[model samples]
Target: MLLNDRVCVITGAASARGIGKATARLFATYGARIAVLDLDAGQAEEAARDIGPGHIGLACNVTDRAACDRAAEEIVARLGRIDVLVNNAGITQPLKIMEIAPENYDAVTDVNLRGTLYMSQAVIPGMRGQGSGAIVCMSSVSAQRGGGIFGGPHYSAAKGGVLGLAKAMARELGPDGIRVNSVTPGLIQTDITGGKLTPELKVEIAKGIPLGRLGVADDVAKACLFLASDLSAYITGAVIDVNGGMLI
Candidate 1:
């Protein structure tokens, strides 16, 4: 077990078909105690229960600093220590530049960028004390290629900020033995894309992808498992691409 006896927290993990939930299940299977944090308290707890025993679920709005702090403290109090954190809580909107109102931009950027910062801030103190930890922030291919099928300019901007933020955090946190990294995932078949794409559109998209298929939630989850585990111990300040050659 790569994460034997470790405690892990994943944000926005309540959705049944989301990447965060997949990551929680994978980590649990690897012997890690998982905590599923989401905006809905009931859903969070339910998701945790679904994952298995000895895991927890909590309500956390990551854009709120106090909420992030409280959730972090609660997890530590319940689980003993936090060895890994996956900042997977995020939201996106598909709007053109002109369609991006202040509210839309705020909704997208606050959840994706501000949430990542707040959650990381909340976890760093505990990690510093332990002198060993890992944080994986979820960026998007939209950030790299400038736009995506579903995310707008604002979403791309937010994820671009994630890449930079993770790198900077990795540099500063390395001295404390806390590794930080980002994962840039391409178009994955999740609730979001499922709602946005037709079967015919998905086929067309797959043709454009070198792997000839859209990524699945498990594909991104496994990449995150690598970064959170000792297999990538020497890696930090790096961005792992889970795009299945779409960007190459």
Candidate 2:
């Protein structure tokens, strides 16, 4: 129960198979009250129900600063204070640089990069005032290795921005006792991958990892838990690779 009696807010938690949902569940299991924020109101509420009573759900579009601010306010109103924030809302567009449309590039950047900024901005004041908090951004191995199997140039650029944002925030917020970090997950099986992965594709991906397997949502969630806990109190501006030695 590293997070006992804490309150954690997870964005993009509506998808049952997403890293955000897994992180929310793990946080709740560790005795933290969760605020599950997603674009879909019903799904968010349903996730909240599954997490048990006292947890809450709110509908928010993180790209909109006002909406993010409102969601933060609502969570504080219900949960008292926020101790952790996991910026896990993201989307991927699997197209070559030449094939990517301007709209698609903007959309990916808006959610992956801008959304992270808005959510962090909305939550930082409370964290600073409390003199302690943790912020985890959902970066990707794509940012490091340029989308080996998951996305394209646009996705890579957007995720790279997340890494930069996390590091900058960590520096600015460390004096206030707020830790900021990013987790770069490799190829993880999720609904975002679209249905089930093909046998050949899976095999090809597995061959590239030293661990010889694709990652699961729990792998990233567990890394997030470590960053959120007091065990990482002295850590900030760090990028934890949950990529199973793929980058190494």
Worst 10 residues of 1 by lDDT: 188-197
Residues 1-248, candidate 1: write the lDDT tens digits: 89998999999999999999999999999999998999999999999999999999999999999999999999999999899999999888888999999999999999999999999999999999999999999999999999999999999999999999999999999999999999999999888777888999989999999999999999999999999999999999999999989888
Off by over 4 Å in 1: none
TM-score of each: 0.99, 0.98
RMSD of each: 0.5, 1.0
Model 1 TM-score, 2 decimals: 0.99
Q: Residue 50: error of model 1 in Å?
A: 0.5
- lDDT score of model 1? 0.96
Q: Give the TM-score of candidate 2.
A: 0.98
